[model samples]
Target: MKLQGTMLVKENELYIGGVSCKELREKYQTPLYVFDEDLVRNNCREYVKHFRVNKENNRVAYAGKAFLPIYMCKLINEEGLCLDVVSGGELYTAYKAQFPMEKILFHGNNKTIEEIKMGVELGVGRFVVDNYYELELLEKICEEKGEKQAVYFRITPGIEAHTHEYIKTGQIDSKFGFTLSNGELYNALEKLNNYKNIELVGIHAHIGSQIFEVEPYLDEVKIMMNLVKEIKESYNIDIKEVDLGGGMGVYYTEEDKPKTIKKFCEAIIEKTEEVCKKIDIKVPILIIEPGRSIVANGGSTIYTVGAMKHIKGIRTYVSVDGGMTDNIRPSLYQAGYECAIANKIGEKRKNQVTISGKCCESGDILITDTNIMDIKSGDILIISSTGAYGYSMASNYNKITKPAVVSVQNGKSKLICKRQSYEDLFKLEVV
Candidate 1:
């Protein structure tokens, strides 16, 4: 397995951020989400540094849907990065963290009325409006409050980006934004002209997540520029923001080859400048909301081996103390992960096994046909590239308690998210 972030070999044991994984397993217990603070913060800086083609107009907004706890929100706030929140819970987290309300961009397909009211009251920076219902609802709320809410019309560019079906949002048939081919895009823009309380300042489009290609982003920029010209000609408007919503894939395993942030920024800036010069349109605020690419590789999950099951003429099953409850990517979208025995890193690599979770369901396998060192009970297994959706999408399947999270830096560990207790599972329940 790849050594990520501060991971290093000390005395033949895996150490992340100066904290030994084996020792961490003994202290925090198995199924722990460990993040290197220095690494995560560095990623934030890297994104901000590379994506800043135009300092006046460009800003990198950290997509909170990837991983949002109060601690993460505070970290993003400290890094001077804008935030993209998709739901009320995320917004609340940001609120509690005292994040700058003016730097928060509200995003969701079906935002609740309460959420809209809260955004309007708190002065959120922008709203990436999805459909007609939400657009009208937000207009009415802003009108009632005697305020003008800035918004960006999310348009589906009919680009079939190569990615999983569940995550591809920019396609023509998707339920997300208004489709350009269906006349809804023009209609939405036409209606926005009359929305007195709404300020249409930009356009946003996201192709998909975990994407490994640069062409798709280039294609998206071209399409957005063309649309921008058409809107300017038809509606006689000047869009100040062109938010090509972020969905750059990260390295999950050796098989996955993702572009560096530098390369990605180069491709995006080159294409954007070329298109803008050709169309004679001034470059607007170039916004990209990267979530996974920023946080995925900087975090990892540590699990304890519990049981090993083997069948004649079949595969070997190595069960860990945690499974779908902690990291459900494998079960959710057939997501792949690479893991290694943290306790015994240099052991012989003669064994091939399938890693299973402690969940009762048979479909709770974490990895299959994976080659790793021999595993035994009481060994710590480190799963890499789980920083994005692992803890954010965790569940209480089979009453399993969610694991705790720790941010490690310079060999010291600080608890960010406390482990859920049994009472937490029933905190919202009644006898």
Candidate 2:
């Protein structure tokens, strides 16, 4: 993916919204996450603009699991985008940010009883019910609270997109939603019909992440449209919303070809309109939970190269202070990333090296084969397309502290989340 927006080099220094990455690193230390606020706002605006072109009843909910912070939550709220929270901690973070509870949509595969009660008490906008157990919990909570909770049944459309099996969630054999192949969805509708406290208003499906092709989405829409028809006919119910969960891919490397947000949304709308016309059903409100596409390219991670070792003809190892602890996508999904020297963006790539992290395991390699120019100690390296899962999946492995996150906008940088310290790491440890 080509680097665009505010995160680019300017005057031989890595600049994010006109702020120098070197200066931010000096202030925040190595292994820091820097985000361009303007880029994120622009992304949301792009989604809003495309969805508003045809006056479609739609809502763009920022998936908080991608990267959640009080500032990020507030920014999404300011842009008029709803929030999609997976756990109680995420819900609490949104609440602390003072995001409107009515605009929050709670989503999770296995929610605790207390979580359901909290959601019910907070009066969230909707809950995407994953399984029958969650439905039962919601029923009990809603009945006890004496309030009818609005919900959407999460269904597995049984359409598996071509993506990493670990990240593919919408397959028939997945552990998430109820599969549509064995008549389980029909049975779910029947069960929902008997519940008076929970109001089943819609259906939800999320195929997978990092999907470049749109055919999988079109196929899912077809199955969902048919299911909508079946539900309306058999149960005599009118679904109010159809949530197509987000899996829109973003450019990670030069090989990735991602569609623009506008094009992707337009295609889905066209398909929905076509299916609705055929089934004689009105188009429901379109809700998309885009997490990665919205922020994956908006942020970058900076690490300082420490030790450089060349084992004759074997391989060159360039180790950084932080490794799989901060960004595990490489080791987790065999993900690919592109990087450049912060101080020398236009330098010639003459050296072939492998980027390694300062960890004890042999699987701590960040980049297998990278072609870059001369490398040395204390050189700053910036990785592209890491704004989504880099910080969110960070761990305390090897007793390494997590990195800090800062926001850059209009040539100014501000610390949004502080780096973890040794004391902070032991705060949760019990004797």
Candidate 3:
């Protein structure tokens, strides 16, 4: 397996952030989520440095849904990146971390009344309103508070980005945002004219997640810029911002080829400037809410091998102590991943094995038909590039406890999130 972020190998052993894998396993135990702190900060710096349309007003909001532990929030704040939250809990996490309220952008398709109230009360920077109902609801909430709230209308540009069907959000059939092709967005904008407490500051659209190309984004920019022109002509509302929401792809396995952050940012900046110049509008403040690309490659999940089963000419199943409970992407999206025996790095890749999780479901498989170094019971298995959705989307299915999370930097490791205890599973249960 190829190494990423600050990984190095010495004496036939793998090390991440200068700490040996065996050291991490010994200190944190098995089924661990490891993050490289320097890598994450570097990614943030890359965006802040390269993802510039107008350096004065453009923003890089780190989508908290990728992995929003409180520490992560603090790290993002420390790195000078804004936070993009999709739920109340994420916003609250940022609040607990003392993140600046004006740096928060609340987003969701079906945001509840409580969440809207929370965002308003907390003075969130912007609300990416999804539907007519949400727009009306936000107006009501802001009026009740006697506050003027900034907002962006999340519209579907009808661009079918090449990705898994489940993650495609920009298509016309998606459940997110007003559909741009059908005049729903125009109607929404018209309705916005009647509201007093809401300020329509921008337009937002997310094409999809794990997207691999730049052409679709370029198309999206043209369409959005045209819409911006029309909105100015028809509604007389100058769009101060345009959020081309993030779905920048990252490497998961050898087959994946993702663009560097520099290239991606340069392309976006040039395109936004070109489109604005052509359409005769001031270049709006550009924003990209990159989530996975910042965290995925910098994180890895380390699990301890438990059982192995081999059936003649069928498959070799290598079971680990953790599964769908900790990382559900493989089962949810059929996501591909690569792994290696941390302790057997130099061994010959003579084993063709399917890595299975400890979950009860047969579909709880992690990797299928992958060639890895020979594995043995008690050996440590580390899956690469799982930092994004693995912990953020984790569940307690089958009553399994989540693993501990640790961030590594400069050969030192510190636990950020503790491993869930059995008591944690039932702590909130009603007697």
Candidate 4:
């Protein structure tokens, strides 16, 4: 993976914005997540620049599930990007960050009544309604509260993109959206049109995550355009927007090649304009919810080597202080990652080993079969391209406290999140 912007490796040490990784590890201790603030801002600018060049009424909504904290919300808000929250906790985090309610887009498959009511009360920018039950609950809440809610119908375009099955969400048989094979989508649109409180303003579709190709999005736009035509013809509903949910892939390994965000956006705009022209409908506003693509490559995880074990004719096990508790991607999706010893960055590859975490389970492996150079106890290992789901999916597994997070920019580093303490784990426990 290409390490761009302020995050770089210098003199056998990782550096972010002129600050060395060794310095960060020293201050924050091992098992740390360090984000390059300048890199993230640059990424945001790249997206906005491309969208502006296309002259599309576009909104870059930061997908908060990747890594969300009150500080992140503020950073995204400062960059002028909207927020896409999937659960009540995410929404609350945005709220705590004092993010503008008008720029928040609520999304989820199964939203509880309280969540629906919360959205209604907060007057969110839009709600991406996933199922019939959620639609019903939204209508009920809006009706009782005498409010008009802007909603987008989430549809399964059935275009299966090449990605992990556990992360794929856009297939026909998936649990997320209204399937296209059945008339369920049409029926739901009809029902939504008749509802007094619901205003169906757009259509939303997400093919999958970690997608590298453009064909899936091209296919999705076609399906959504057809649905838009049907909705206009049947109900005379003038859809104002079409959200092609974000799944643009980023480089995780040497073999993975992903298109630039600018190129991806241009393709989407071209296809959307073509489809809308063909259907004789106005081009709707384009919204993207990019989570990993924006931030995944902008951060890295730092861990201190705890032990090293060599087995003859088998493999060497290099263990770190943190395991699945800090990063669940490997365990969840069998995700592949690349790492370099922070203290020995320029050394030649002298050993082949598997990086293991300090956890009880056998499955708590971080990287399997990785090439290393002179790994030893007390060396610092830095995992790259972990900015997305690493810290967000962290747990207190085996009662291991989560690590601290620091944002580096312009030769300076500031702590954004504090390391979890042992007392934090027992605070919620009952006697």
Candidate 5:
């Protein structure tokens, strides 16, 4: 419904990066993932501007879990943003891309020992320690490696960020981090002192994902600041950085009004500075791991219309070749999206249709009850804002092959990820 990034409708045809969507569909085939290079770069630039500071004390790590490929990692490195990785694959992608190891921060709740080994071996900058086990394990690994690793203890601030229940991380009962309300946070910090190899530089807190309000983040800052002040009074140690995990919501539908990045950044910086001033503590390096907001709306999924089913007085079902295998956010988080007939844009919109993925599961719907122009077989259906987790979380469900990913910039396009062939579905399988 809304044109974003390089998206424009010329002569009623949807064009992204000055390239035609129909052309992309023809060249790359349907169920394609399209990322706008300039948009991603612009998002990085805009996010950097608002969150900018001297390189020594401030940084923005693009959460690579959103949509990570070697090329995109290269883009992130080129754009001068740090990379936040949560798994070995993500970290390995960064490593293989020759991403500056000093700019990578590792995170995960249940990171395998091998993953930890890989990160430490690759000289990752820091690890957002999730639990005591990871802290102890990482410390031992660092000791074994004869190296010092900086770390930030993840603190659960017990704030229920108003978002989907599945995505909330800062709540007290979450499986993420040490709960601030409990004594374990202090215990964890106190225990950290014994690990000589771990230099606990700061604390990290992520209230939740897909969050829209700034007040929650402001609350988180104040809460974390209070904790930092108390830690200072109790332990006489200073926190040098505070990584607020990114969850700035973006436009998924017309009714979703996400806060502007500028306003959000301003509020965060002003509040952090204000709190630091009030607490008489130095403003630490503020880190935000933005994944969805930075890349979500900058990408779209192109699917071809197949069969149409209309239940009398119910809804029209337009099946696309791709579904739950490519993008599962709709079913996983009840996510919403806006789609249009890429080849038939600028036409009179008279039909309301529900888009269905070809997945065998009944819950494999993409857009529910959307209004599109007349749809027909072979029509290109361009779904918006799928850059974040579409490809990253894709699967081979029903043995459906995954689509290729293309990055478009300045009317030029380049393939970033190759489509999975049927062989890819069972490449690693053994009889």
Candidate 6:
């Protein structure tokens, strides 16, 4: 198994963040999401440290959709990174975290009036305008509030990133942003000219998520910079901020090879500088919203193995207590993950088994056809790189309760999210 974020095997046991996984399983119970706090902090610091062209002009915003608990929000706030929230709930999370209001970047494709009003009332720093409706609606809201709002036009650059089809956002046909090839962006700009309450302060574009290549980002920078120049030349509008929304990938299995954070930062910074220098325009406030890369490898989900069914001459189904209830990635994206027997790390891999979850659906497989040590009921199974969308996309299928989340650091562990109880599921149901 590929170990990450302070993971090491000591005395034939797997340990993460200096805490033994066996102990974590015994204390926190199985089907638990464990994040290395030190690793998360270090990822934040790396982005803050290396992603710079001008110290004052660059910002790193943690995309909260990946995996956000209140504790995660507080950790991000303390790490000096900005927050990018897509909905009112995330905005509220940041607000509850007491994150600096001015450091928040609000983004969404179809932001509702209530959400826009919430951001406006809370005094968020930047609103990434997605479509014409939002553009006009935001102006109306600002006019009603008698306040001026700064926004970035999220333009689709038509770059097809190499990723799953569902995740590609920068294509011309995507629902995310105004397409650059079409006249929609120009029309939006013309509309912006008539709005007095809204200020078009920047431009934003996100190609896709879980991207492994840096060339796509360079392509994104080139196209966006050209748009900045055209807007400057045609409309004399100076876009002072440029947000290339983040999709940096992380290692999941042996087949996955992602770029280092420093390399990604260096490549992006160099490309932006080159384009700015070529266009003879000063670099705008460059921002990136990294979600998965910051948290993915730092997290591991530990589950207690149970109920082994051997299909003779075919495969073995090793069941775990958790499934789509706590992690839905494998079912959703056909995502592959590396796993190991936490307590039997040193054992020889002799069994090829499919890790099945407790969910009723047969699609609830977590890791399929993977080799691991011969395992019995009650052995611990640790899946790596589950920190990103595992819990964030979790569901209560079969009405199963969600698992708890804990962060480990320096041989210490703290619960970040409490496990849902049977009663918690019916908390909102009408009696």
Note the Cα lDDT for every prediction shown. Answer: 0.90, 0.88, 0.92, 0.87, 0.90, 0.91
Cα error, candidate 1, residue 244 (Å): 0.5
lDDT of 2 by residue, 200-308 (tens): 8889999999999999999988888888888889998888888889989998888899999989988988999999999888888888889999889998888999999
Question: Please, what are the lDDT tens digits per residue for candidate 6 over residues 298-382?
Answer: 8999999889999999999999999877888888889889999999899899989999998889898999999999899999999
- Number of backbone clashes in candidate 3: 0
The better-scoring model by lDDT among 3 and 5 is: 3
TM-score per candidate: 0.98, 0.97, 0.99, 0.97, 0.98, 0.98
Q: Write the per-residue lDDT of candidate 4 for residues 337-369, one digit (tens) a residue.
A: 998888888888878899999989999999998
* Model 2: how far residue 302 lies from native, Å: 0.3
What is the C-alpha lDDT profile of model 5 across 334-427, one tens digit per residue?
9999988888788988889999999889999998988889889889999999999999999988889989999998888899899988887777
What's the CA RMSD of model 1 in angstroms?
1.1
Candidate 2 clashing pairs? 1-253
Total backbone collisions for each predicted model: 0, 1, 0, 0, 0, 0
Q: Which stretches of candidate 1 lie over 4 Å from their true place?
A: 53-56
Supply the TM-score for candidate 3: 0.99
Winner on lDDT (1 vs 3): 3
Which runs in model 6 stand beyond 4 Å of their true positions?
53-56
Clashes of 1: 0
Worst 10 residues of 2 by lDDT: 48-57
lDDT of 1 by residue, 16-131 (tens): 99999987887888789999888899888887778883365588889998999899999988887899999888988899999999898899999999999999898899999999
> In model 2, what is the error at residue 127, expressed in angstroms?
0.9
